[model samples]
Target: MRSAHHPATGDLSLPEVMAALSDPLRIGLLRVLADGGERGWGELRAPVAKSTLSHHLRVLRDAGVTRTRQEGTRCFVTLRRDDLESRFPGLVAAVLAAAEADGVGGGVRLASDAA
Candidate 1:
């Protein structure tokens, strides 16, 4: 299988990262990933179609907010927590805290939450 392109930690741009986090759905995804565990693509749940979810994942990956690994036909994703922290210094934590304070992902029903 072909490998996915991930920008180097140094190559990650603030504008791109901010833009990627601009969407509520993407923030919801981040909230799920913030637990610091890698989650399979099939494991994520959202109100949108699979294609739309895929698009959001791609946006996060391209922006360097997350890392995606392909294992055979499955794709697993994890938030690039260390890299993001190193690059931006507490930005992820602040965003996540703010998201929680504002109930950002409260409406998005994740598969794990359904269990």
Candidate 2:
């Protein structure tokens, strides 16, 4: 297991959080991590390339929605559930519930999955 660190604690500003979610990829990653739990690089690469994935993760991390740490040579990503709750209260929960209500996990409808 990888141990990710947060430099600080608090809810991200609306703009900061929105900027992180601005990319379809980051939102998808959040869903994957939320549904699957503690995913590593290999598990996250299918939706994007390494470089692109890194960028997406960085956005999420900066916005305080996600955190990452080095586990050996691989980096693991996980949602900042506790921190988010402390900072924004219901923000993360609302997002998850909204996704479930929409019957979508990653905020997008797949071809195999209907809207």
Candidate 3:
């Protein structure tokens, strides 16, 4: 599996992070990852094509908002909560809180939620 590029936490830029979070689909993905657990690529649910989803994931990963790990043929993503918090204190929590309040990514459903 080809490795995904993940910028160091200190290299995270506020503008890039803000741009990554600007998309609702990306925000929804973050909502699922907010629990601070690794989620398989297939486990993330959104009203988008698999290719589109891949794009959003790439954006987040590139922006340093997420970390993706490859194992075999599968990829798993996790929110870089600690890294994000360290780089920009309270930013993740604040954006999540706002997204929740605004019902952002409400259409997203987690695989665990399907049970």
Q: What's the lDDT for candidate 2?
A: 0.67
Q: List the RMSD of every prediction in angstroms.
A: 1.3, 4.9, 1.2
Best by TM-score: 3
- Model 2: pairs clashing at backbone N, Cα or C within 3 Å: none
Q: Which 10 consecutive positions of candidate 1 have the poorest summed lDDT?
A: 106-115
TM per candidate comes to 0.94, 0.73, 0.96
lDDT of 2 by residue, 4-106 (tens): 5454675467778867776656666666677546766665543455687677777888777877878678877778778777877887778767666765535
- The digit string of per-residue lDDT tens for model 1 on 48-84 reads 8999999999999999999999988999999999999
> Local error of candidate 3 at 54, Å?
0.5
- Winner on TM-score between 1 and 3 is 3
Q: After superposition, how far is residue 64 of candidate 3 from its true place, in Å?
A: 0.3
Clashing pairs in 1: none
Candidate 3 residues 5-112, lDDT tens each?
Answer: 999988999999999999999999899999998999998888999999999999999999999999898999999999999999999999999999999987776867
Q: Candidates ranked by lDDT, best first?
A: 1, 3, 2
Which stretches of model 1 miss by more than 4 angstroms?
Answer: none
